[model samples]
Target: MNAKEVKEILDSAKKNDVFLMEAVWTRFFPASVEIRKLLAQGEIGEVKMVGAEYGVPLFHVPRSDQKDLGGGALLGLGISCLQFISMVYNREKPESIQASGICLETGVDESVAVILQYSKNRMAMFTCSAGVHLHGEAFIAGTNGIMEVLSPMWCPTALVVNEKVTQYPVPEPSLPLNFTYSTGMRYEAEEVRQCLLKGNETSAFCLL
Candidate 1:
């Protein structure tokens, strides 16, 4: 289905009293909660900047060539990066957005790079590609140190303060597969339940 059609379906479901939501899974997980806690407790200090990227090399796929299918790096991966930025900054929209990309044969973007500027001199750099394998990592830089989230989409395992560029101990595992890993999706669902219980429509963590 086209992007517009998908949006329409979601709207219809919402109107019909159904819990219709886009499956943006990262917002509901343990990593997100920990990140939120850190931000709240000033663990990483004041968040000064954010950088994230997501990309995949879909070179020869037919659906990847169709603009009508929302086939492009911007829609595919850029949205995820944007979501990360939005979540970290408390769902505030960027004050300004500057984006550029390359259009491939089927009039779909092959790659894109965007810069989003937010309040308090905070900014985020985002990139996406359908032409190359991406090393997806997200970093939130603060006054004290930095918080690094590896694989922001699926398993957002976080890293604590690395004081020096010297050697550091191996990071411990954050979640177990199917058990704790599934907590990501469940956390988000619980957020929805809490919001409804509180007579709210949107979640503070995963607001769209």
Candidate 2:
């Protein structure tokens, strides 16, 4: 759907009794859930900072050049980076946000970097580019050690704790099209289901 339509639907859901939300599939995955638990349990100690990056070259897509389609770094890669930060920080929206981007020929953002400051002096740096190649990984730095999410956006196939790299196998989900192997999306669905069953409007990681 178009941006207007999507916004309307979200509004409708708020007005209605349904829980409407953006489909941020990565936040719901098993690895992500585990990461949250690790943080809560102090396995990673006090989280001091986080760093994440996501980007894609939109050179081949015509819509990428159209601002009306929300074709920009903020809406595209920024969304992904912000979503990643929210998930890592247990769905807490940043207390403050500072951002800047480079505009393209179509007046859309070609690339952007955003700094999010949270409570307890915790900070997250997110970056995205529609004009460059990027290794989409997220890092969580704490006092004791660090946790690394490799491919945190889509497959989310592996996670490394500190210096010891432990890989979790991605479960094959029976889904459609290019989403069949997506462990991230399925995990999010599971979290939603759990929340609904518990009569909770939000997940433990939900900011709102």
Candidate 3:
């Protein structure tokens, strides 16, 4: 998992007192910011569970089906699910994990489902698939109400809160996928630029 290498890099970065960050652009999305606010403001009560799924039909691509080239649904889409959970629950590692997946001949996973249990009875269930076309939806359920991150949750343009279906709008691309991203990536880049200008080691919104 390159865990050791990542740790070393972080340690080195700290020792050198430099800024280093992982490229998870979702954190900078307006929808993401709104979700954080909703949780902090107790709009959804105390979050007890989070579910997320991101899948696309890309099995025909060489870079996706090849193991040596780091092809797998988990490697491709699971990070976003992990990020979604962290955005809700912070950076604490899951206390227990359960996973199952289907793999191709190259031993690369075509699909993966993982359930991560955290302390305080909180849980996160995430699924990523390469052979399927999923809605890329995410759900956050709490004691009082629930929040749904719209389709393509990783870069969604809206969030639906509660049974009343109260919609909170987020910024959308001037033209969908105009810059190779349905959700404009400029917001994240701008955040990074601000951090650099402020000499901050990491973003206040998006953590590595």
Q: What is the C-alpha lDDT of each candidate?
A: 0.73, 0.76, 0.84
Lowest-scoring 10 consecutive residues by lDDT in candidate 3? 175-184
Model 1, runs deviating above 4 Å: 1-11, 152-154, 163-203
In model 3, which regions exceed 4 Å deviation? 15-17, 164-183
lDDT of 3 by residue, 1-208 (tens): 4688789988998999998888788887777888888898999898999999999987788798888787889988888888999888978789999999998898889899999999999999999999898779999999999999877787766788885544434445565464335445777888989999999998877665
Model 3 residue 1 distance off true place after TM-score fit, in angstroms: 5.5
Best prediction by lDDT: 3
Model 2 scores what on Cα lDDT? 0.76
The C-alpha RMSD of each candidate to the native structure, in angstroms, is: 5.0, 3.2, 2.4
TM-score for candidate 3, please give it.
0.88
Model 3 error, position 167 (Å): 6.5
Candidate with more favorable, higher TM-score: 2 or 3 = 3
Per-residue alpha-carbon lDDT of candidate 2 for residues 77-158, written as tens digits (9 for 90 to 100): 6677777777767667689989888888888888898888999999999888888878788889999999888874544668
On the 0 to 100 scale, the lDDT of residue 197 in model 2 is 85
Which residue pairs collide, candidate 2?
28-187, 28-188, 90-205
Question: Which lDDT tens digits does candidate 1 get at residues 20-48?
Answer: 45567776666666777778899888898
